[model samples]
Each structure stands twice: as structure tokens, then as C-alpha cells.
Target: MKQLKILVIDDEKLIRWSLEKHLSAKGYQAIGAESGEEGIKIFEQNHPEIVLVDNKLPGIQGLEVIKKIKSLDEEAVIVFMTAYGSIETAVEAMKSGATEYINKPFAFEEVEVILDNIKNKLKIIKEIQVLKRQQKDIVTFDHIIGESVQFKQIVHLARKIARTKTTTILLLGESGTGKDMFAHAIHNDSTRHDKPFITINCSSLPETLLESELFGHEKGAFTDAKQMKKGLFELAEGGTVFLDEIGEINAATQIKLLGVLENRVVRRIGGTQSIPVDIRIIAATNRDLKRAIDDKSFREDLYYRLKVFQIILPPLRERRDDIPLIANHFITHYNSQFQKNVSHLNEGVRAMFLEYNWPGNIRELRNVIERAVILETMTSLQPDNLPNEMIGKIEQADNSSKENYTQGNIGTSGSIVEFNIPNEGFSLYEIEKQLIIHALKKSDNNQTRTSKMLGISRDTLRYKMKKYKL
Candidate 1:
């Protein structure tokens, strides 16, 4: 660990010498300055972690020095050293930004205890900074996996908009279509990527609490608000604030949000001061805001404010061509997570995946693949390894389609024949052979036409012919 550097600003020579001697002996690097001006100069030169300022300095007062130091470094930790008669001055110094105050003629043991407490607070602050950096690293654009045409188009647009620092982005999509992931990607790719990226689900909290969470509150603002707190907007200053399920926020909150978007300033609950914030707002929702506006549930002006640059994420069913790629990506991910060696999905599994309509979008597909990867005991994922509900849904769809075809209701021209199975359970192989024979006879033994009619590849048709001895 690095040694903590301290600056002591005192007019008295004995106080400065004694503090420097005791602190240096305790493994702290202490620098002494006579008067507040000299102390401010030393603070700028060395940038000490802690400052001990005497309230009754000769030239510049301790409160003025505290204000100057705070202006230089807002996070600078300061402690005021005051005489017994100057307790009110010390309090004024604290109001000016000094972290703590110590009385005159105090024991060295009390100073030691104060220094120890300051060290602990400094450690916690450092840890929080490290965690914020880690969070920024984790939410980068590289984590979003997709190569489909629609997905790539959305990603390209996101990357393009991410270069702008002040643009408001709206992500419109279904519940599980990865809107949150897109929000993260936009933030991590933006100019403010290194700063805090705060997220809050607008629907998750009550109206009063949501307002407090978004706009923050002063100490004693409410019954439970025992201390002052910074809201998501303040915490995400110089970065991004992601508001998920934004449609769920009430009308009053929506009006406040519009003011932030317009003025870039937020007022804390029960606080008169309006704090300016530099942040990009990314709001996402599954609900239709236009319909909500028509229903008078959501404000039209707020909706337009949020939709400055909107990206609508397509559902998974609309992008079926990307399923195999996404499924394999999830398979590889889960293989490492579960320590399994499952390689790929079987042909039947792939066919079933293609036939099913994924109502829950990419999230549902990921969950299904994760479950299959965990349960698979073989080298590949099979149809039997899929969830029973999924298999049943596919079977029901097939049955419905077959029934529609038999009733001559499947096609616009109504030219297809009704195919019925016997009650005794006919052989599937025999049925396939008869269908191929009839196709060949109808096509006058022309392999191309026979293959076309049978809806099979020419190679598959030839293989079946040889196997059936036809």
C-alpha cells in the first residue's frame, strides 16, 4: 500500500512541528505550511490525500482555503483544526467543504483515531471507483453477439449514434428482444464510455420512490430519507443513464424527465437547487408509446422527446435465419459455463427450431439452449433434449398444418390433395416410397420433375429410388 500524504496548515510552529513528527513516525508523509495560502500552494504542488487546516490562519481564512481546495479538487478530503473558542468557525469550515473538524489541545491519540477513520473512508472510495471502472468494462459493445442482417443493421446504427455524447436514444422492442443489451452497447461505445453507466427500471419502483431514485433527495426529504443521496441522473453524469420500461413511469415523472431532456438539469426532491448533468439518456420499453399517448396514459410531448433517435429491434421469429448462428453461440457459451463438450444441434432439433415461433425472442432462445446444453449427455443436442413444451408446440403446429392441407384450406389455389393417415398407424417408410413412386409416374420418370414434385433434392430422390428398388 502507498503511504498516505497529509498537509497541515497552521500558524503556530509548535503545532505544525508536533503533527509532522507524530504523523511521520506513524508512517504517514506529513508536510507543514504556515498560513492557508502556503498550504493551498503545497496542496496544488503535492496533491495530498488529507488536509488539516487551522480555522484561524493569518492570511487566507480556513473556510476560504477549503472553498479553494474544493474548487481545485471536488473530492479532496479536508479536516479542520479549530480552537475551543472557534467551534462555530469549524462548523462553518465544514459547511464550506471540510470533511471533519478537530478541537485545539487534543490528544495525539485522538488525531490517530481520526486518521485511521479517514483511511478507511478513503479505501472505500477507492474500491467504489474500481467497481465503476469494472462495470464500464463489462458493458461494452463487443458483448452483443449477432451477425444477422437486421441485427447488424441495428448495431451499425447504434455504433453510429454512439459517437454523439448528448443524443437521446429510444429502443423499441418486445420484452425479451435485447433492448437492454443495445442500451449497454450504445453507452460503452459513446464518448462518455469511461464514466458511470447507471440503469434503473422505471416500472420496478413506486412513483414516489422512483422520483427520488431518478432525481435524488436531500437529507430528511422523506420519512426514510435519513441522508442526502445522488440520483441516477447525478450519478451517471458525464456518462449514460438507461431507463428501462420507461413507459411505466407516471405522468408527473414523465414531465420531469422532459425537463431534464430539455434543460439538462435536475432538481432533487425537496431541494431548491437544480444540478446540471452531462449525460446521454437511453430509454427502452416494450410498450407502444403512441397507443399509450392516445389512451391518455402517457404524455405525447415526452414520447416525442424520447423518440429523438429510435431503434426498433426485430423479434427473433422475424429473423429465423439467424437462429442456428445464435443457438450455436449460446451452445458455445453454455459449454464453457457447464463444462460440457456438446458440439452442435442434430438435424431434427434444427428443423424443430425453425418451425417454432419464438414468442419470447432471443432471451427465450438463450434459455432453451442453456437448458439443453446442461441436460445433454451426448456430443450433440437432440430433439429429445429440448423442453417438453417446445416439442409439444412444434407437434401441434405440424398437426394443424397437416389438417389444414387435408381440408384444402392451406393454399390460395386449393390444388393440393388431402393426405390422411390410417387409424392402424401406417409405415412411414412405405408412405414415403408410394409418394415418390407416384411423383415419378406423374413426371414420366423425369428425375428433375419427380424431385421437384416430391420436394426433395435430386440426390435425395435418386438415393430413395435405389433404396426402394424402383
Candidate 2:
């Protein structure tokens, strides 16, 4: 940080010089004035961050000087100087905008202590301003790069619901499907964009700690709770609270969260008062919460409440046409990040990305591009720049499709459909089960590859597999 200017104003020449000299030696750029009028002129010209003024002055009183300076800049940190006899006047000076008052005979050490405290506060304020700017500029609808119809529709729908006063938004998607991005974009696009957008992953903490974090505990509420604390919901008032991995919360926490959703109020663990909170709740998870509800792990009522504005982000493989476009976007991003001149993916690299099923979705693609950008010596991304496992997976898929096609299996795309119907009519369940088994066998029992062969999510395949007792 640059040197902070401190203005010292006193009627006595010695007091002004002594304070300025002491503060100047301490690294501040301290200046002085003989009278309140001179101090006002210097203050308006230089805009010093801190001001020290005396109670009795030649033309104007110190309290009057404080008011005038405050009129010019309300954020000015002013400390009043007075004698033992003028303590009453010091109190009056405080009422008129003085930050603190010290006796005239006070030690220079006292002044240094006050200045150190003010400096700490100024540093904190500056850091907060920087963080706010970064948050405001980082995530938005415009930054979401997708040209596919499904992706565009999801974005448009999210934008529409963001403008509303919807209390709860449930983002359903697989891991790495950009649920976190959607949560941030939705909050940044909402009416409370300027407020804090606090987020937490419920699964990251133990059940007890997660409960305490959500509904803050009072002092002495628990052994380690030394003081009263405000929870994220209270801190995020007038904005949004993103609860990632919401399905991971336990039954007790689920009941409490349901209360908050119903009443828009939260009570600390050991407190009696219900603090009202004005915020939207954005819950996201990669789990099949509907299945969890059936298994009694998730509360049905809470699911319905959170699903008021549900948005399911499709997997990356479902939007194959956007792979090249998304890859180019990541290539440009990593190019700027790593200071590289990587232009675009070569045709081989492009086909490898399209041929492979991105089980990790956009996040996986981003990592692939970032690695390629960092390692590639040529201008354009090449096949060797890709991960070896990706190429291996593609080779395996090609061989499996060919083998299944040669076996006269209709599961492979563009293959002829030739299945004999039982004379007594076939059972659809048996046919569907056999097809999944055949696909799994050809794909070497890999869930990701098997899901791609069946044109479904890995989670869906697991559910069907469980249903068919396979």
C-alpha cells in the first residue's frame, strides 16, 4: 500500500510539528496546519485519509472543523486533541463526527496505536472492494459458451427464472455439468446481485459441523462455540445461499432446512429468537434425489419445496454438436491464462473429443484443453496432446461397435434391427434387459462406455441395472 496522508491541525506550532514529525518517521506522509481554516484548505486540496484536530483553535473550534471536513468527505478519520479541562469539549467533538479523542498531554505511543488500528480497518475495506469487483466480473450468462439448442434453451430458462423472486432453485445435473456456474450466474443475474452470494458444500463437513454452520450456535451452545455467530443464511441476506450436495445433509438437518424454507427464518442452535432472512436458496446435487426420496434418505416435502424452479443441465455427451465450440472456448481461455498462442484443435484432436464420452462433462474437457495448451509446442492442438486414456477409450469404443455390428446386434447405431418376436408375444422388460446386457458386454462392463452405447446417463444405467437385477 502507498503511504497514507495524515493531517494534523493545532493552534500551537510545537504541537503541529511534534505530531507531524513523529507520524512522518513512522512511515505516514504527515502534514500540519496552524489553524482550523488552514487545515480545511489543505484537507480539501490533499484529501488526507486521517485528520487530527485540537479543541480550541484561533478562528474555528475543532468540533466545527470536524463537521466541515466531514461535509467534504464523510469517510475522513478524525481524532480530536484536547486538555484535561476540555474533556467535555472532546465529547462534543465526538458527537460532531470525530472518530476518537485524546488528551493533549497523551503519549505519542497512544497516537501510533490509534493509527495502526485505522490502518488495519482500511486494509480490510480495500480487500473487500477488490473481492466485490472480482465477484461482479467473474460469472454471468454472457460467459457461458454454448451454441447447442439444448444448452441455449437451458440458459434462456435460467435467465427467465433468475429475474423472478423465486425463493428456491434446484439445479439437477451430473458432476462437472457446470451446476456451480449456473448457481453463480443465476445469483449474479438476480435483483440482489450486489449483495453477498455465499455458498457451501454440505458434504464437505461432518453432520454436526454442517448443522452448526447452517444454523449458527450461540455462545456456550457447544463446547467449541466460544462466541455468538451468524450463519451463512444470515450473512447472505438480500442475496443467495448456494447449498451444494444438498442431498448429503442428514435427516435432522433436512428437517431444519425445511423449516427455514417454509418460514424464511432461522434460529441459532441455543437461541430463542427467530431471525428473519431475505434470500433465495439455490440447492445443487449430482445425486438422483428422487431415488433418494424413494429410499427414505431425502425428505419428500423438502424435495418438492426446493424443486419450485428446477433446472436439469444435460450431460456434455448429450450435446455432441457443442463439443468443438466448447473446446474452442476453453482453448481461448487457457491460451490467455498460460500466455500461449494455441489457435485451435487439429482435426484428429477434434474427432477424438467428439468420439469419446465425457463422463466428467465440461470440467473434464476444460482440463484436457488446459493440459494441451500447456504442453503443445505447435500452434494448434494435436492428437498427441490429448490424454492417452481418451484415445484408448475411443479405440475400445470403435472396436466394440464394430464387434456388436458384426454380431447383427441392433444396439449399435445404424445397424439393422433384426429381433424375433415370441409366438405368444414378447415381454418388453426381457427385451430391454437383454439389450442392456449385450451393450455392457461389448463395452467391457465400463459404466461410462456402456451408458454411451445405450444413450443414457451412467446413473440411469445403474438404476435400470438394479431394476433388472443385473
Candidate 3:
């Protein structure tokens, strides 16, 4: 665990000594300063987590010190220590971003209680920050639902590359194939997981503003630039910077980005000094960069720079075998989110899901499941609960299949099969058993291929085969 560092700033020698003694006994590294100026200098040198400022100081009042410390680090937690009859001053300190106030002439026990309270607050704050980072990073691929060979291979490659420190990664896929999720997973799995993971979409901003946003600017760099500001690259030092839609960046910005990749340094928009940065860049794009290079829309050198390690995420249509698993994952997720008890997708809905091409990929499927979960009252998601577009596509495919079967075209192309149920009502278990046997025979008893043909997992097929005494 990291030790807590505290800075106690007071004009009174006894108060400073008492705080230093008590804080040190409590296992904190406490430093004492006799005035506000001296305190600011110490804070700059030490960068302590907590600062205790005396409300009345010899020079440069405590409120000014609080303001200065906050200006240096906005998240700096400061507490104002005030004498008796200075409640108004303490309130003013609170308004100036002081976290809490400690009244003077207070007992040592009260000081101990206040220090413990602050320590607890700081701990909770640090935990929350870590939680937020994990939520953003781990949730992406931690519970990724897939068992298809192609999907598994992609995940394996991603995991293999995530252990490296400096390899630039490029995710190539369609818009909704979860490139951002892969980026987050790679960052979270890397050595810089504790550091920041910053994301910026290239196409979301205009060219000039986008440049400034990435490289930052010095004071008076632009009409709106009033003070020096750190850019995303500077802020994400020792971590990952995920640039989504990297192909959309303009030519000039592309040149600058290429420089950053080659030199590992960034220059502010109007500043001359080149600040070195240590960051892992992970870029994603749906556009064809090779074609963009041909058309002179993207830089070829930069494209090669970004593709040092590339992962192409397969579209959902190609991984239909994983739909059921992914859908069930969403059902479980939305059950807690929307407070619904939807346990599964009905048979008809499941069939429709397998038939649909899923042109928008996983994102569209997640949205569909979320909608169904929100509006569904039954225990299972039904076909009618699906979107109109999906239902129409499924119905159209069903009609086409029926027409083909009527024309005796079933199995002619070896792509379509027709099964008929008698009016007396056949057993679903019997039908499923026969289908499984047929699939097994078609695959030459290859369970993996059979599972793919049935759009189920190999484990599920194995369990069913055992249950059916096959």
C-alpha cells in the first residue's frame, strides 16, 4: 500500500509540532511549514495528498494558500484549521475548495478524530477512482461472450499482444464490432493499468480543435486559450491513448501524429518545447486505410506505424454460433439493469436471431436485447419483442425458404434444409435429437463442426449427446 503524505501549514510552532507528532505516530509522513509561502513550496516539492492550512498565517493568508494549492492540483484535498470565533472564515475556506475545517483550541482527541475522518475520506476517494478505471477497462472484455473459433482466435491474439509495453495496436473492423472494447481490454491488461486510459474520437471534432485537444496549448495560444493546459497525451503519460476512428484525422494532424509515434514527443500547439511522453497508442478504424492512402486521404507511413500489431474483429454475421451466448449474456445483464426476470429468448426468437445477418453487429444486438428487456413482461423474450426491421428480415427469409422448399430446391445447393412437422404434433425433444444426429453424421462425428452447424457450443452439444445416449 502507498503511504499517506500530509502537509501541515500553521504559523504557530506548538500547533505544527503537535500535528507532526500525532500524524507521525499514526504512521503518516507529516511535514510542517510555518507560513503559507513555505507551505506552497513544500507542497510543490512533495505533492502530498492532504494539506492542513492555518486560517490565519503570518504572510499570504491561508485562503490564498488554499487557492494556490488548488490551482496547482485541482484534486488536492485541503483542510482549513481555524481559531475560535472564526466560523465565518472557515466557511469561506470551504467555499474556496477546502474539504473541511478544524476549529482551534480543540482537544487532541478531536484532532485525532478529524485526521482519521480525513484519512477514511481519502481512502474512499482513491478506491472510487480505481473502481471507475476498472469499470471502464475490465468491463470491456472481462465477460466477453463468445466461443466461435474465429472469435476465440482474435481474443487469443489480443491477450498475447497485451503483455507487451510499447507495441502499437490497430483494431480493424466495422463500426459496431467492439473495437473500443478491445482497446480498453488491452490497456487494462497491460502494465499501465493503474495509469489513465484516455480515449478520443478523431472524427468527432474539427481539425484545428482536434489538434489542440490532443497536443494542448500554451497560455494565449488561441483566442480562447487563457492559460497553459495539458493535452490528452500529456495527461495519459505511462498509460494508453485509444484513438477511435483514426482514419478520419486530417492530413496535417496525421503528420503530427506520425511524429509523435516516431519521436515519442509532443509539442504544444503554440509552444516550442517538445515534451517527451511515454504512452501506448491503440488506434481503431472502420475505413480502409490502404485505399485511403491510394486516394491520398491517409498517410501511408503512419498507417504502417499504427499496424505494427493489427487485430481484425470479425463481424457478427460470420460468428452466428456465438449469438445465443452473447444474447444470454445481455439478458443476464439487463435483468439487473432494468429489474426484469427475462431468463431466456424463446425458440422462435432464437431462430430469428440466428437467421438475421446482424448488419450493425454486436452493438445492434445489445441495443435490441436492452429494448426487449425493458419492454418485455414475460419470463422469456419472444419474437414479437424484437425490432420491426429484424422481424421483417426474418419473415422474408422464412418466406424465401418456404418458396424454395415448395419448388423442391431444398438441399439442391447444399445450403438450405427443410424439416416438416406433422399436424399431430411431433415431440420437440425427438426433433432435436434427430437434427443433432444428422449434424454429427454430416460433420463425420466432428463435434466442433457439428456445434458450429447447430449454432451452439461444443460443450452444449457434448452434454446433449450424453443426455440422448448417443
Reference-based TM-score, model 3: 0.65
In model 3, where is the ten-residue run with the lowest total lDDT?
Answer: 407-416
TM-score for each of the candidates: 0.63, 0.65, 0.65
Clash list (residue pairs), candidate 3: none
Q: What would you estimate as the lDDT of candidate 1?
A: 0.87
All candidates in order of lDDT, best leading: 2, 3, 1
Which tens-of-lDDT digit does each residue in 260-307 have in candidate 2? Answer: 999999999889999999999999999999999999999999999999
TM-score of 2: 0.65
User: For residues 1-470, could you state the per-residue lDDT of candidate 1 as single tens digits?
Assistant: 59999999999999999999999999999999998899999999999999998888898988899999999999999988888887678779889998888999898898999989999999998999999998766766687777766788888888999998899999999978889988988887888888988899998999999999999999999899899998999998899999999999998899899999999999999899989999999999999889999999999989888999999999887776677888888999899999998989876687677668888998999999999999999888988778899888888987786665445463454554445656665554675677788878898999989876755445456667876899
Candidate 3 regions off by >4 Å?
1-137, 400-470
**lDDT, candidate 1, residue 81?**
85
- Provide the lDDT at 432 for model 2: 68
Q: Could you give candidate 3's per-residue lDDT for residues 372-440 as a string of tens digits?
A: 999999999987789998888877976786665445454446454556646675555675687789999
Superposed on all Cα atoms, model 2 deviates from the true structure by an RMSD in Å of 15.0
Better of 1 and 2 by TM-score: 2
Q: Each candidate's lDDT (Cα)? A: 0.87, 0.88, 0.88
Kindly indicate the candidate among 1 and 3 with the higher TM-score: 3
Q: Where does the lowest 10-residue lDDT sum fall in candidate 1? A: 410-419
Q: Give the range of the ten consecutive residues with the poorest summed lDDT in model 2.
A: 408-417
